[model samples]
Target chain A: MKEGKISLEEVKHIAKLARLRLSENEEELMTHQLNNILLYMEKLNELDTSNIEPMHHAVEQVNVMRDDKLKPSLSSEKALSNAPQQNGVFFVVPKVL
Target chain B: MTEEITQWSIIETRRRLAKKEINAIELVETYLKRINSLNPSLNAFITVCEELALKEARYYVDHPDKLVEKPLGGVPIAIKDCLCTEGIRTTCGSKILESFVPPYNATVVEKLLQAGAIIIGKTNMDEFAMGSSTEHSYFGPARNPWDTSRVPGGSSGGSAVAVAACLCPGAIGTDTGGSIRQPAAFCGIVGMKPTYGRVSRYGLIAFASSLDQAGPMARNVQDTALLLQVISGYDPKDTTSILKEVPPYCEEMKKPVRNLRLGIPKEYFAKGIDSSIEEAIRQALRVYENLGARIVDISLPHTEYGVAAYYIIAPAEASSNLARYDGVKYGFRAEIPSPDLIHMYLETRSRGFGSEVKRRIMLGTYALSSGYYDAYYHKASQVRNLIRKDFEEAFLTCDAIIAPVTPVAPFLIGEKLDDPLSMYLSDVYTLPASLAGIPGVSVPCGFSPEGLPIGMQILGNYFQEDLLLRLAYIFEQETGLSPKYPSI
Candidate 1:
């Protein structure tokens, strides 16, 4: 967190967390690139926003509540229409255990 | 017939179809023929929707009476590939979803069809709408029609090219940090990113939920206005969608600018902007001044921090939004014979996403990861608040803000592709407006000395799209300038 450069091992660990496999070459390149970017992003620290709030939704939003009613939805078959791997009614995936 | 038909606006297309001066088949065939000849040079479309377009046109040809009720009946329009189309493969310019055929249509696409617009095709874009240039797309980079050697700005590059080249009368594009507006400026077309919740994002492939909004891109302002009318509204499914009533955009856009006060932010004209672009914007301001509007110099003190804050906030959202592409439910799956689910995820993602996508994902994941969240994402979000407040205070003194859409004109295709930071910096002008969730329009102001199209951005308060459109419409109508059809 101290304005330090991101290490190569840290880049690989982040990639793993994101479920992405990077070539050793890509990891090195990304580590360098991300450092340059994060360094530039340090410009944000120039502003004093101690009293400012973190803004998420640009406009005000409310948790929309609707009357629960039975409505038509994408049929189970239609929902599975684009599944890369699927059985008769469900998507197929690698064993969790 | 060939040249004239390809340039017909939605209004002209509707009139001609109604009079039988041009039938749907003739119109569709004319554009299809042009696309076949021109698309190869520009690489504008990922999928042309040829059969669907012709079929939709054929329906109107058979049912002429129905045209009275449909506003955009028989008009050809291009959609960005990121928006889902029921059966048309919706690849968000990533090989991961190269064959993704969404079972439902994005709300805007559904709106287009309901208005009787023909789905001409889905345009190419940066992978998952990540980059400022289309060079990151999996299929190929979409070149600027103006000069095939240059980029057409992105992630709506192909949509901009499609309209600029007269391949389509209108196109729809999504903007999350200048995707639509930058491309529109680069291609010399009119593009708007409405107030964030004004347009529904029901089936739009999520990039950064908070910043993303689909908008209209067209050859001129009124056509852009008409297109916006069709797509603007609330949807029960999109909870973030505002429950406000849709305005009659074409009518509201006709208001004169006699007493209008336009703000010129001092920070926007600072370093990094091309001298010619600054002169062109000042020149455009003279046109508005001559038309009886007042120009006021203002300050957006937090402007410099926009790119930095946006980089942190957008990727942070994207890292979460893009987590859905894990290879099981839909889209690409790596073929490695690994029984481990985790390995399968890693392989699928690694092989599926392009370099820019990976870079952002990692940048985002690292920022949101343990220990760095408060320092990066939180700090950036607070900076975002300051930027938004800057716009709010500026609007109090002026009706709207005017600035250049990008710091520079469209660069050569490979010019900044290798340097991610530079490419990110190019979005400086457009990102502040986007972060504020305010409505903004990009209209052609002047051409660069090299003849590349330059767009002047008009930013207004939230849900002020009609005012944005009106000012842009007056500027466009007064100048009567539209980019010439690229020789390609």
Candidate 2:
């Protein structure tokens, strides 16, 4: 967890993985912000948590669930009303390479 | 008496229903009227379930005997749009789901319905619960009920505002980072984010699954306890949902606060915090001290890394969680004349989600992407473990931790909307609680000079919500500030 500098290339790469088409301005801004964030996280590296086992659950908890029962469902029309583009049961979309 | 019904607390509302002072229909009407009058300016609700709420209220009137089983019995409340309410428009404030009505109620919503709580409406939120301000919502930003020019700190902005404006006695808000607490703080209401797994996330649209939690937002501590009592418990549908024995949250209210230990994390009050907020927290600590609770100085050294660690971890998870919203599924579908799935996804997502959400999604996607996973996302999780440990150690020293919910009071509508970094900092004080999966309650502590609400957060140990509620109830009583509703 070294406090190494995060470059614009890293931001661009992250965006690509995220499938985001970021403009040049956003990439430049994010690089500056993300780097500062990393520098701050570097301070956390100084903390001694070696002896403490990593604790994920704040309180011990087990399977939380509901009875498997069919409940009243919404109409297909209502369900798809929010779709920006739809064709019957499927949502319509643009072409990909 | 007309306004009395609308302004009553959960207890009073129930009491009136029992005494037949006002029927459920009248109760719903008063609130509907208030919402009708005030919601135009506040923009607190995206989908107002007026007809359904009225229908439910009328049913309660005809079947009063059923009230015995319903703990929330006839109390009207709002649900954050992110939580799917069966047959209701459960838009997470994005155009992608703008017309989408969920086929099922989120587990919490079902629980609320069973408890006799009337579904008033779905409140607005930052689109996909991504921003500190609800400005990113496609519907429009929720205005602070106290001051229209200022924002009701969001993504639960609408829910908090609805409760604050007396449109609903209480509301449910999902917290990812500080969505619930920040808006609750800004709106000057009582809001609690129970231990991460304390409540089920079955129907809650994911922001960051690990960090997301749903909790009650109310006008006072006891109502929050009441709401929590109903909505909390184990749900198998949500894999991350914790199965734990449900405690009588309301029963804890009767417990007296004496000889309680409160911890003040010094790092939270460090440089960059606003003076007024610091003063408000100090004043609240004084109230706790006056109540005979021992206030001790404790250090959560890793607190400084909160905003940074949260950015990496939240986005990384968000990028993945949000990927399902592609055109093929239920949400916004982009028009790809050439019939390419990838192009459809890109076009739909690009057109559906807002800029800030897109930014975080991109950042998260990047962090979780190959080659960068270890350096960014994995490293952040490790740091998260350390952050959790910091609270564990602090709890060993004190019963609870008290701090300001946000660095400053609510800012103007457009104040930091453009500055993502500053907006990210808004959750600096509150993120640690979510990261560590601890319970935190934000109660109105004081008001700023310009008359904005300031809230102080109470952080408690895991499954220590009883202690958290008891302590908050005591402080709320001592301050005589529990029932002060914001002037609309």
Candidate 3:
């Protein structure tokens, strides 16, 4: 783990965690590009942020709450309209276990 | 006459429609004709809804009673493909969603339709609004109408080019780290990013949630103001939407620029700016000085860290937001032998997302992964806070800030394609304002010696869009620079 350098093995690990299957060529390209960006982003480490609070939202707003009354949502048919693979009213997926 | 009609501002188009001098069908046909001829060369639009737009136009024409006082009566506007349009394919410029048609319209789209604006088409964009240049789009890069070889800035490049080439009077664009304003500058038009949460993001495809904002891109400031007025207001659908009352932006455009204290951040002018663009911006400042506005020197000391912070924060958010596109859900699914759910997810994502998108997702995953979270994402967020505070202190002595939208003018399309870091640097000037969650408008100030257009960015504090519009409108009127459309 050289400072700010992303190796091919690490790129593969990150891609798997991100649910992306990278080919060998893509893994190499991603390794090179991500390492370049991460090295450049090391500029953030130069800033002294000892007392600073991390900003989650650009604008400050309290959590918005609404009544728990039932509301209309997309019908099952409409919700399934864009599904890649569906069966009857259910979205189909690969076997899990 | 057709050229004149296509080039008319939204206000003028509305006036003519109200006066019955021109009907909606005639306007739609004229734009359709222009699009038919020019879109091939410009590659600005992904889909042209000729039939749907004509139908909407004819309905307005036949039922003259319906046109009484609708603000955007019969005007055609292009939408960035990233927004959901019911039954219209919203590709977000990725293969994953190539066949995906949204089930509903974005809040902004609904608002535009209610104002009687007809949908012209869905414009092209950088895939998932990830890149700064439209070249990253799957449909192909949208050529700059100004010079076919040069690039129109992106991920809102198509929207800007559509408006620039007169294919549409105005277009909707989403800006996350300069997507809207940068393209607007490159295309020589008016583009604005309203304050964060000023417009609802309920149905806009997520890019970087905290940084993304939908805004109006038009030929002039007045039309931009009108479009902004229509799409803006509190929407209960977006939880982050502020409850503040929407101000009369178009009306505010009438206010004088007297006594306005404009800030010229010393850091923006430091280095890396093209000499010609600096001259144009300086001349624009002189025009403001002559118009009775005072120029104040201010320091946004943390400006240099804006790009670095933005890259981390945006991709971190994008990685989380984009995790929803598994094979079982909507969007693209790879045709592979999936032995298990994990394999399915991996195959779908790899085949679905483009290279830049994959790059960002990987960067984000690593940044948020264990042992690296505190050093990268958390540090970037703290830098973001400092960046915001810089703007807060600067605005105390200045009503708005004026700066170049980009360090250089619109570059050759493939120049920065391979060099991702350089492409990221192109957004240096505009990213700070996005990080601060302020409203910023890019207005055409002058043209470079090579004939490419340059734009000056006007930034105002949060919820101060009215003031930004007022200043931009005054500048547009005084310089009369925006009328020179690209000779497409």
Candidate 4:
């Protein structure tokens, strides 16, 4: 693994991006886990990729776009039928404010 | 006779359906009964749509003359709950959307229906396809049929288990990382993840939008090929859907890989691999050699970066994709008296998502959030590119890569539940294919000393599913390892 040290705060930062509110216990757990993972990845740092171009998709397809067209869509009433609560034409929920 | 019927392949089933030896209703009912009996132990299905399945079966029976003998006509298949099915619930194995039903069917579902396939039910999965072991499902973890105490690999665990247990002849599973292949390996079934963009994802719930792809899980390579033929094609609704013509997947199965070159990546064989798995793969390679194929040693030096890149890229996309689950839209709504919209968002998210999913979403959010995007998310994507490039370089000298799908055989239930890293290790060999958007197939190579299944992965260049399935088919025939069923 090529990478070095990762901070506890960095783990917290990544956790927040993940939308997880971790307990202190989890933070401690992830700090150890992520560090070990980075250590494993450090092996890649030894590889010489300076001459190689990065690969994306295996195939050489580019901009395989479809023509814009209108098609039938589900009615709002049908779309929101399973909503726990709904307003007319839209699913409803508790007011944010 | 009915038991024999349950064991037939998709092609055999289609032939029987054509000859009128078995009508659609009997076919559907056989599976419904099997599912009822075996699912208790496997926990493969979340909802059994018996009424709808029978209704569709009745239609097929009543109009047998009009049936065109479509590729998968009257074949019973299980679906991962993450794929939307019109008029049926699409909970994605999350309690947050327990009551959520979609008015539209996913593109793959629509394609299956058009081909006259009968859907048995929705199978269990990781909540929002987050975890590697279906343990994250609010419903329950799907068990390995070989040993009821063991786990079926997840996100697509239920799909694989259903096919393995003969509850359904085939099923559809989505793989973002190793969701499809890992579970298939664990359950001793055949699972294929097509090249990214080969299958349309219009209505499949997003995990990592860029990485998520739907594929087939079945008892054999031929059945997987048939399912792939029916469900694959370009869809205008999906902007990312490839417009390139899809090869006849079924016909590809009949093609032989005589004189083909197989590559075994050195990185894949590193110290982390189980010695037993390595031996099985070595044995399989000798079989390939006897079949007129030559083995080449190759190095994918960047293989080590796959999991790290995947964790970062997957979460970044997952955080954005799951944002739609807020109380404002059609998913789960929590009643919380909050001071502002932000508070409401937090309350709904906090209450709606599972712990693992929340953790990922937060990680993703932080990765993409201000100030850290370049350091974490962007850097990860660059590494993803490097990982993908590694495959390109290896493919330059070899036709396909053969390696162990997982290091170890199926572990007992709750074995890795507390350790997320251990669970993620199950996907190590399977993730590179997804990261590179290449086609990969997992075939049952041998059983562990404990009698649990072990699978070897065959990966091919993009759009080369023909080569992928052919290799698997050849091995299936040579080993004569086909037709092993789980004991009740």
Candidate 5:
């Protein structure tokens, strides 16, 4: 296997890195699918882009600064309104430390 | 009143509302009734905000003078579920955000409401705007109104269906890689993807930040121009939005289409294209020729690599943009794993996202992973530059490019579900324009032998929507095909 391409182990590793857990069957199926897609993405190698610069942003942008002024922002209640688990003042999640 | 609501455009609705021909409430009700009756079979909407729509309509009943400044006044519109609607359930067609209600409306939604347009509902789409077919939706796929068996080309399939069936006068859809155009082509409506940064993406759920753009969908070119006029302009909220002044698109739409040079890229008309769709585009060109416009044969040599580059770039951006849906955020959080936060995060996303979304995440992560970033993401970005150069050089000689939106018509719902590569190939014609950060529109040109619709793609240089809409308008006037209801 190449350094970047996907095997079953590589698929599992990618899923882990992506914060996803695929079942055994899913990992196998995904390994197969990712290999096919990666093979297809090789078509981009046909073009010679040796001297061309990589285009990142679609539009060319300079520094975009805004006036630093007091603005009304979303309240704590409103911001956390859609949280699945939340206390009155804070969003509740599983322990980190 | 029912007869009129079936074909009422944004402009016509405004004129009639001002003349007291029909009240706003009644017009909204007629469309709402149609959506209620037809949405059961079509499944075009994820959430139908009937009460909210009614409340908005009642405001116009008392203060009729407000219609003067509001061009889309009293017109009922549907929004693709990807855009946030304050106080409305915005699922983005994914279970991760299934029960999530936004506290703020997307900038496009804000513009639509300010223009006095009543948002009737949030239309279904591919989950998080990822699929070429709307079948990826967790809410289930939206059926094509033309043929209930065939798929509505998507990620914006529901919006296309809603407008095609006259459920609403117009709708808004976001496009990263042909999301808006392909569905618009399939449903026989006019859908446009504005140049990147033309419309504000302030509250839009990010798919691919660089390629994602919101545009208008309607039954005809004139209504599309009107809708585009409202949503475009500079927004400080989105730093990438251009600071240029927006032109009067509706006024420019009335101008002549004579002497305009339309470029027909040979790559679009290559051997792999469906013969009937090619013929339909040729016939549309003949219409342009008769209208005193000239067609030029051009070449976009880098066209073959578009899907490859897009697949690499879009998913890479998606993997990053969609990383926000952890268990801690405002969307859905699963409870299966409880040992620690990492376990909970893994379980929640694994269960929350469907197969297609997971596929993209994996693809993107692999492309951006260690020891592979240069080979995949960087190489594709360089290829993207070459593709943009192709359009830049093509536009030097041509006023606008005329081509096919999709190489083939809409396929069956489950035909390409198992094979992601085939589904990705279906967007070859539209992907290049998206990659180049240019404007493109899919206007209904003809139908296939099976009676499904095909759309002709017209792409313009960045922020030159007026010229593109004008060309589409002239074609619509000549063909007289759109603005008719499908036999639902």
Candidate 6:
């Protein structure tokens, strides 16, 4: 949690968690750029915000619920229209096990 | 006839269509011809729905009775590619969704169709609305119509240029930080970002969920207001949508800005702003003063922390929202010959997303990671509240706040491409309003000496879009600035 320079190893680890496979050049560039951004963002620590609550939503709208009703939705054909690889009803992906 | 049709506003086009001055098909053809002639150089539209637009316009032409009932009947409007259009490809300016077509229209798109506006095409934008410049687009950057060498500011660059260059009467653009306003300023058109919940975000490919709001961009304030009326309302589908009654925004323009208290945030005029842009905004303040509106100097104390906080909050949300694009259900999937599921996810994402998207995802993941959550994300959110409080307090003193849209003028196409931080800084002034969920409009105020247009942003309290439009309309009428067309 220290506000210091980010290492290439850290960038690679973060990218891995984000499910991104960055190249050697990207890893180096991301390390430098993220560190610069984080350093700039460190300015936020300057303000004393112990009393102020963190805002999750810009507007104060809570529990915006709609009536539960079964309505027509996209058909199987339309749902899988944009799938990279699909077999009419199911999306094809790499073997999990 | 084509020239006249291309220059008409939404209202003017509707009036002409109703009076038989121009048929719907003729109007559609006028814009289609212009798009074909200019889109090659400007790169404004990724997919021009010529046949679809014609088909819709012809329907309106044949059924004049139906055209009369619709507010935006026979009007040709372009949409930013991020907004989903049923059966039309909505790329969000990335190769990841290049071939993906939406099965259902976005809430705004559905509203536009109901209002009789023809969807001309899906315009270009930054890849997932991430970059300030459209250079991050999987498609090439949309060039500034003013100077082909310069960029029409993005990620709604294509939508802005389409309106600026007369490719479309008006276009819909979403603003997370300054995607709509900055681009509209750079292109010398009117763009607005309604209060966050004012417009539904159902089919808008989420960049930053809380910060994103879809609004209208047009050649003038009146047209912008008209288009906003057509698309603004409650949608039960989008939970964040406000259930407020949509006001007659165009009618509200008739009210004068005689005694309106306008606040000029002093921090925005500080250093880093180009001299010419500063001069133009100051001159605009003077014009408001002369028009009987009092301009008070105020300070948004937390203004400096806007960009820093926004970068944290927006990315964190984006990291979560974009996680859905893991090459499982839809979009681009890597053709890897391996039984390992994790490798496919990595390769698919790495190859699909652009550098900016990847950078944000990494930054977000780092911020939201186990130990760093309280440090980065939590701290940033607390600061975000402080920034919003600054606006709320400022509103108690003034009805609206006035400032420059962007600190600097539109730079060359590749000027800030390499420096990501510098590019992020461009949204410094506009980000505060977005963070506060306030409605802000960028009115074409004046042009820089380089002839690139400069815009002044007028911001109002949440759901005060009518006031923002009224103020911008007065400025537009007073200046009587003729629309400058880019000679392709």
lDDT of 3 by residue, B232-276 (tens): 988989998888999888898889998899999999997899999
Give RMSD to native, each candidate. Answer: 1.3, 3.5, 1.2, 3.0, 1.4, 1.4
Alpha-carbon lDDT, every model: 0.92, 0.84, 0.92, 0.83, 0.91, 0.91
Best by DockQ: 1
- TM-score for all predictions? 0.99, 0.91, 0.98, 0.93, 0.98, 0.98
Q: Write the per-residue lDDT of candidate 6 for residues B11-58, one digit (tens) a residue.
A: 888898999998999888889998999899999999999999999998
Runs in model 3 with CA error above 4 Å? A1-4
True contacts kept of 5: 0.88
Instruction: Give the DockQ (2 decimals) of all models.
Output: 0.88, 0.36, 0.85, 0.37, 0.83, 0.85
Q: What is the overall TM-score of model 3 with all chains considered together?
A: 0.98
Q: Please, what are the lDDT tens digits per residue for candidate 4 over residues A10-61?
A: 7676655444446788677666665665465454555455555544344556
Q: Across residues B32-151, which tens digit of lDDT does each residue of candidate 2 receive?
A: 998999899999999899999999998999999886558888889999999998889888999888777777889999999999999999999999999888888999999998899999
lDDT tens digits, residue span B285-383, model 1 = 999999999999999999999999999999999999999999998899987775678988999999999999999999999989999999999999999
Residue B133 lDDT in candidate 4? 80
Candidate 4: residue B353 Cα off by (Å): 1.2
Q: Clashes in model 5: which pairs?
A: none
Runs of candidate 5 with Cα error greater than 4 angstroms are A1-5, B1-3
C-alpha lDDT of residue B443 in model 6: 89
Q: Tell me the deviation in Å of residue B119 in model 1.
A: 0.2
* Superposition error at B147 for model 3 (Å): 0.4
For model 6 the local lDDT of residue B203 reads 97
Q: Estimate the lDDT of model 2.
A: 0.84
